[model samples]
Each structure stands twice: as C-alpha cells, then as structure tokens.
Target: MTVRIGIDGRVLTDRYHGIGRVTHELVRAMAGTPGVELVVFTGEQSASRRFDLNLMAMLPGVEVVPVALNAVDVRQLWRWRPLLRGAMVDVMVFPYHLGAAPLLGRPAVALVHDCILETDPRFAPSPQVGFAYRIMTALVARTATIATVSRASAREVERFYGRRVHPDHVIGNGVDRLRDDPAAARRLESEYGLEPGYVLHVGAQRPHKNVAVLVEAIAEVPDARLVLVGSADERFPDEVAPAIERYGVADRVTRLPFVPEELLGTLYARAALLAYPSLVEGFGLPVLEAMVSRTPVIASDVPVLREVGGSAALYVAPRCARAWAAAITRLLADDDLRDGLVAAGAAHASHFTWGAAAARLVSACHSLAGTYLAEAAR
Candidate 1:
C-alpha cells in the first residue's frame, strides 16, 4: 500500500533557512522512495514575495498544494484543521513545532529542531514569542510523534517537554560536498574584498552564537581576517559591533548580511578554517558543511558540536576569547595539523548523507501510517 505523506511546506514560503533547507532536501530525497507519495502544502504567494519550489514540484510522486492564506499569518491556524483533514493523507509531517497543534488524534510527525526558546528565554526576541513557543511545543508534545535532528536535541526536548523520542526517530542532518570554483572565487574576492584564507563564520548574530568572542579572538590574531555571513537581529543588543569597535579590528572584518548558496559553497571552499563558537545547538550543521568542504573547523566544546565534529575539529571554550585566539593562531601557523584535520574531517563528514536521513524518516512515517490504519480498522 502507498503511504500518502502530507508535509507542511510553509517553511519554503519564507526565507530559506536551516529548517527550510532540511525540508527541501528531505522531500527531494524521498521523491524516489518505492511506496511513498508526498503532498506538500505551501502558503499562497503575495505580489511582493514568491517561493520557488519548482525542483520538488517537478519530481515524481510529489504534489504541491497552495492554500489561500500564508502559513506565517496567524489566520492560517484557524483553517489548519479543515485543510489538513481535506488532504486525506495517511500521515502529516510538520517540519517545525508551531503548526502541529491541530493534528491531535492524527498520525502526525513534528520535527523539533531545538528547545532553545524554552531552555534559554533570552533567545526569544519578545515575551509574546517566548510564550507562544512554550504553548506550541506543549501542544505538539501531546499531538504528534516528536523527532529531532540530533541526540542532544532529543535530550533537550525530553528534558523540557517530558516527551520521549524513539531512538529511531532521532533523524539527523546531512551535507553535500562543496565544489571549488575558481571564477566564482575571483568574483567573490573582488566583490566582497575577501582574502583567500580568512576565517569564516556562517550563522546569525544571535547571542548564543557567541560571535562577539570570535571578534575579540580575531583582534588577538592581527594577521587573521574574518568573514561573517549572516544577518544580525536588531531586537537584541548589537554585541558584535561593540566588540569590533573595542578591539579596533573593524578593518579586518567583512560582514555580509546574506549570500547565495553557491557563494556560500565557494566561501567554505576557500576559507582557511571555519569558526563556530555557538554556546548551544540542535545540531552543528556548519561544522559538517565545513568538513565536507575540506576545511578544518574550530567549534565550541559543547556536546552537540562534539557529536558532529568528532576527532575532526578543534574544540575551544565557547566564551573564552583567549582560548579561541590561541586555537586559531596555532591552527593557522601549523600546516601539517591543518592538513591532518582536513583529511580526518572529510572522512568524518562522509558518514552523513541525505539518502540515509531520508530513509530513516520514511521508515518511521510508514510505520506510523500502518499502525494508524490498523487501529482505525479495529
């Protein structure tokens, strides 16, 4: 029997971020599965913005359905029940926690990327958002089969929501190897004033990202330059700007609010090393991406990063500027050490592939669908 899987593709309608990337890749990967059909529900596009899901929509066994309302709008919640019921799918997958509240008594899967908003309230920009996060997570805990991107995240979810995640449902993330482009390299250098071997950081300037300490560490290594490729949240205090000003290293840093995926691959391919000092994470995706690009990495000694980096990455305290500086300086000066890490990292990153992740997720969904069908017949 074919298992019809309904996916909440609302993330695709917004700006493409980590969660959206995961959904896109997984859907693409599952497109060729033997007995699964994908029905993706997307938000309506406005005159100002349009989402491109052409790749997935063109795939066999995949159907894209556009609802009348935008998923990000609160009005969509009131219409979710009827829309979901009307799909007549065997299983529904909410890629994130927020929209699964209406799926109670249905065979549903909710992917909880992290519990940062609940674990660290400061991560939430406002009290309203924080409260909403708490309520949605609690609702989903009762409504869906919860899954997470890493064992660390599964632990966090269980700790915060008291919901046990099946070991098989801890579906992790994957990365593809980045190709080296010489022409693009030259273009990036000219456009962004980028140096070939500068340190690279590729995430938002959130407080937990610990980018301020990275800035301070860059100050300690005068010859080293840094590229920050993510946007800053104005809702929080500008920690990175103050750190740059204090250290007088404004000239050594290049901050790009955003970059296309192709350029990001080139940046990863050309960087001397990747610095990820995030205090916590659901999964350290940048570490895996950097390793796949054959770049050595320096990440925090946090458990999730350690799980991702293994023996391939250099570990440093998340908050200590001095330690980060020492690690950076040491890694830069030692060519042998960098080469060794590059080799080890490539091998380590190869173990994570989108095919494997998609297989595990499909197996879980199939089981859920079969169980629900049997129960209904009884």
Candidate 2:
C-alpha cells in the first residue's frame, strides 16, 4: 500500500538555519526514495536564496504546495490536511514538530529536534513565546508520535510529560552528503580569514554553549587564538568581551558570524583543535559535523555529547575553564594526539550516513502506518 505523506515545508528557503537545514536535507533525501508520495506543504519560494529546489522538482512524483500562513489565518494553517485529506494519506510528517494540530484527524509524527525552548522556562521567549511553545509541546505530548535526535532529548520529553509511554525515539541527525574531496578544501577556504593554527569553535553564543571557559583558556594559551565562527549574543557581550580583555587576549580571540556551512570543513581542517563545551544539546551536530571534517574535537564530558562523540573526542568537564584550557593546550602541542583523534573521529563519523538515517525513518513511518491501519480496521 502507498503511504501519502503531506510534509510541512515552511522552512525550505535560502535563509536556511539549523532547523531549516534539517527539514530541507531530510525532505531532499526522502523525496527521492521509492515507495512514498510526498506532498510538500511550504511557504512561498524566495527568489533570493540558494537551495536545491531543482533537485526537489525533478523527483518522480513529489508535489510542492505553497502555504502562505499568517496570524489571521488560523484554520488555513494546517492546509495539508484540508488540501490533501481527500487523497487519504496514511500519515502526515511534520519535520520541525510544528503543525500537529492539522494532523489531529489523521495519524501524524512530529520530528521534535528538542524541547529545550519549551521545557526550560528560563529560555522560553516571552509570555506569547512561552504560551505558543506550551501549546506545541502539549500537542506533541498528547497526540503525535515523536522522533528525537538524541536519547537525552527523548528522555527529557518523557520526564516532562510524566509518561511511562515512550512517545519519542532516537533516530539521530546525519551530516552532509558531500564526499570528502581533498581539493575542495583549498577551493572552499580561499575566501575566509584562515586561522591555520587556532582552536576552533563554531556555534551561536547562547548561554548554554559555555564559551566563556574558552575565553579564559585564551589567557592561558597566548600562542593560540580562539576562532569563534558564529554570531555573538548581545546580552552577554559585556561579560564575554571583558573576559577577552581581562585575559589580555583580545588579539587572540576572533568572532565571525553566520558563515556558509560548506566552508566549515576548510576552517575545521586548518584548526589545531575544535573546542565544544556546550552544556546542552538535542544532539551535538557541530561536533559531528567537525568529526566529518576530520577535525580533532575536545568537547564537554556530558551525556548527550559523549553519546554523539563516542570515544572519538577528548572529553572534559564543561564548567571547568582550567580543564578546557588544558585540553586545548594539550591538543595544540601534540600532533600525534591530534592525528589519533582525527583518525578516530573520521571513523566515528562514517557510522552515520544519510541513507541509514532515512532508512530508519522509513521503518518508523511504516510502523506508524501499521498501527493506524489496525485502529481503522477495528
């Protein structure tokens, strides 16, 4: 039997961030696969952004339907159900865990990246933000079968809802489909300010990423600068900038924002080490991305990250600034150790491929369809 899936494609644009990247990458992969009819419900295409829409358009029978949703049009939001309901889809798949309300009459599965912005009241945006998140969480918690990137996130979801029921599973995220081309590195790095011998860190300066420890470490290792390749957080720039000044290492630490993902490998390849001391993650994607780039990684010895990094990365206490500095210095001074980690990281990264991830998702969807069919039969 054919399973018709109406996927919410609101995030498919040139302005693709992490969530958008995940949504676009997965849909791109899934559309090409054999047995399913994927009717994509998306926002209007932006002429400005660079995306693989031609690849999406070329797929055998996948349909892309644009949904222009606004605050005023509440009922039209779940346009997939109304538009494709007559098609009688076995299930609807929401990649970002939004639009679950439209799937109420039909069996739907929500790919929940994490419940961090919702479960942690402190990180919750505002009253409006908090309320909206609460509603989304409630929808996922009560109705949809959830799919999470990491076991830690799944456990968090389970605990918050006070459920013995395993509402979510650990499918995990995959990295770029692009092969490791030796020549591509040179071509990619030509434009960037290459820090050939720096300790690299790439991510947003969110409170949870524990970047200040790295700043402190810059004072200890005057020889190497910390290359932060993501945007700075305005709230803590005073706190962060002073640490850079206090350490007398303002020259040693550089912060770059919103870089192209492809050039990331060039940055990683040149790094003496990649430092990721994040306090939280649904899954440490940057670490995995770094691993794929064959960059030696020193990350916090936290559960979710350790699980993602396996034995590939050198792990340390996230809160200990001294420990982070020591790890950076060790990796910097020792080429043999760096080579060992690079070999291990490359091997660890090889275990996660887009094909394998897509297969797991296919299995889960088949399972959901089977359950839904049984209920309909009764």
Candidate 3:
C-alpha cells in the first residue's frame, strides 16, 4: 500500500531561514524515497517568495498543491478540509507545527525545532508570542506525533509538554559540505569590512545565545576581532557596545545583519575560529556547518552543544569569559591542536547527512501512519 504524505510547505518561502532550510532539504530527500508519494501544501505568499517549486516539479513522486490556507490559518483549515480529504492523504507532516489544529484526528507529524518559548520564556519577543507558543505546544501534545531536530530538544518537549502519550522522535539537522571560495571571501572582506583573521560568531544576539561572552573574550585575545554574522538584537547591542568600548575593541568587532549562504560558507572558511557560546540550542547547526567548512569550533559545554559537537569541538564554560578567551588563545597558538580538531570535525560532520535524516523522517511517518507495524508480517 502506498502512503500519501502531505507536507506543510509554508516554510518553503523565499526567506529560507533555519526551519525553512530543514523543510526544503528534508522534503527533497523524501521525494526521492521509493515507497511514498509526497504532496507539499503551499500558500499564496510562498508562491511569491523564493520557493523551490522548480525542484518539486522535476521530482518523480512529488506533487505541489496550492492551498488557500497558510500554515497558521487555523480558521481557514476547516474550510479547506475537503481538499485534504479528497487527496486521500494518509498522514500530514507539519514541518513547523503551525498547522496542528486542522489535522487533529489524522496521523500528523509535527516538526518542533525547539521549546525555547516553553523552556526559556525570556527568549520570546513578546508576551503575546509566548502565549501563542504555549498554545502551539499544547496542540502538539494533544494531537500530533512530534519530531524534533535534536535529542536534546525532544527531551525538552517531552519534559515540558508531551509528558504523557504524545510520541516523539529525534530527526537531527544536516549541513552541506563547503567548497573553498576565495573570491566569495574576498568579496565579503571588501563589502562587509571583514578582515581575514577574525573570530566568527553566527547567530542572532538573543539572550540565550550568550554572544556578549564572545564580545568580552575577544578583548582578551590579541589581534583577533570578533565578527558576528546574524541579525543584531537591540538589547544585546546595548550590552555588547558597553563591553567593546570598555575593552577598547570597538573598531575590532564587526556585525553583519545577514550573510548569504555561499558567502557564509566562505566566511567560515576564512575565519580563524567559530565561537559558539550559546547557552542553549535545539540543534547546533552552525557548529556542524562550521565543522564542514573546515573551521575549528569552540562552543559552550552545554548538553545540546555537547551532543551535537561531540569530541570534535573544544567545549568551554558558557558564562566564563576568561575560560573562553583562554581556549581561543591556546587553540590559535597550537597549530597541532587546531589541525587535529579540523580533521576530527570533518569526520564528525560526515556522520550527519540529509539522506540519513530523511530516512529517520520516513520512519517517523511510517510509525505515525501505522504502516510499519501493519506491514511487518510481509
């Protein structure tokens, strides 16, 4: 029997951020899988954005369906329910968990990236957003089988929301191998005012990201400026500006709002080190991306980071600026240690490929649709 999988393709928009990248890559891989027919449901907004309709059009088992409802269009889902029923979708996979309400009785797979709002409420931009996250969490717990990007995040979801009957699976994220692009690096250097030898940090300056520690640690390292390549949080800059001014490293630190993927890989390739002092992460994607880019990583010694980085990355205490600085300085001076880490990181990174992740996703869909247990006798 063929299982028809309906994927919520709202995340396939032009602004392909972390979640969007996960959805796009996983769907592409799953579309190539032998047994299942893949149907992607997209909205009008996505049609106008940088959606991957071209690739879907080329794939053999994939069908792209335009829906009148957006991902968060809970009110519209009921009105559009007939379309889903008519298509005979065996299971629905919501890559972002925003469309959980409409498919309540169906075997729905909810891809929850993180429980930041549930576990770390301070990270939510506003109270209204926090409330909505809580509601979404409840909806997942009540109606769907959950799939998270990391084991750490799965545990968090189990602890906070799905404490009883909701099933959870860990389908980790994957990174593409970086190509050496000297021209891209030179362009970034010229356009973004980035010098060659600087410590690189890639994340939004949220509270839990702990970027200020890097700001302070950079002051202690000699001739190494910190380049932050993410959207700046206004609150974090207030804290970072003070530290940079006090350390007199104002001119050394460079902050770029958004770095395109090709240039990002180049930036990572050119950096002296990738410093990720995040207090928490669902999955430390940048760590793997940096590792694949052949850059040595120094990240916080948190559970999630430890799970993602393994022995490949040098772990530092999250809040200890002195310890972070010491690690950076020591690694920079020791070429042997850096070489070992770079080689080990590449090998560690190869363990996480989209093909492997897509297999896990297929298994999750099989489990949710009851196809595995039912067809075991065959």
TM-score of every candidate: 0.95, 0.87, 0.90
Number of the top candidate by TM-score?
1
Q: Which stretches of candidate 1 lie over 4 Å from their true place?
A: 13-16, 45-51, 72-78
Models, CA RMSD each? 1.9, 3.1, 3.2
Indicate whether candidate 1 or candidate 3 has the larger TM-score: 1
Please say which candidate is ahead in lDDT: 2 or 3. Answer: 3
Candidate 3 local lDDT, 1-378, one digit each (tens): 567888888677744357777888888888868789898887767352334577776787988887777667757447545666777777888888866654434578777887776766677777788898787678676667778888788788778885433333688988888766778977887888776768999877677788889888988998888998777666333566677788888888998877766677889888889999988888989999999988999999988999999999999999999999999999889999999999999999999998888888888787767753355437
- Can you write out model 1's per-residue Cα lDDT over 46-107, one digit (the tens) per residue? 42122358767899899988877654456655677677678777888888767565533468
What TM-score does candidate 3 reach? 0.90
- Ranking the candidates on lDDT from highest down gives 1, 3, 2
lDDT of 3: 0.80
Which ten contiguous residues of candidate 1 have the minimum total lDDT? Answer: 43-52
Q: Residue 144, candidate 2: how far off, in angstroms?
A: 0.7
Error of 1 at 140 (Å): 0.8
Measured by lDDT, the strongest candidate is 1
What is candidate 2's CA lDDT for residue 329?
A: 82
Q: lDDT of each prediction vs. the true structure?
A: 0.86, 0.72, 0.80
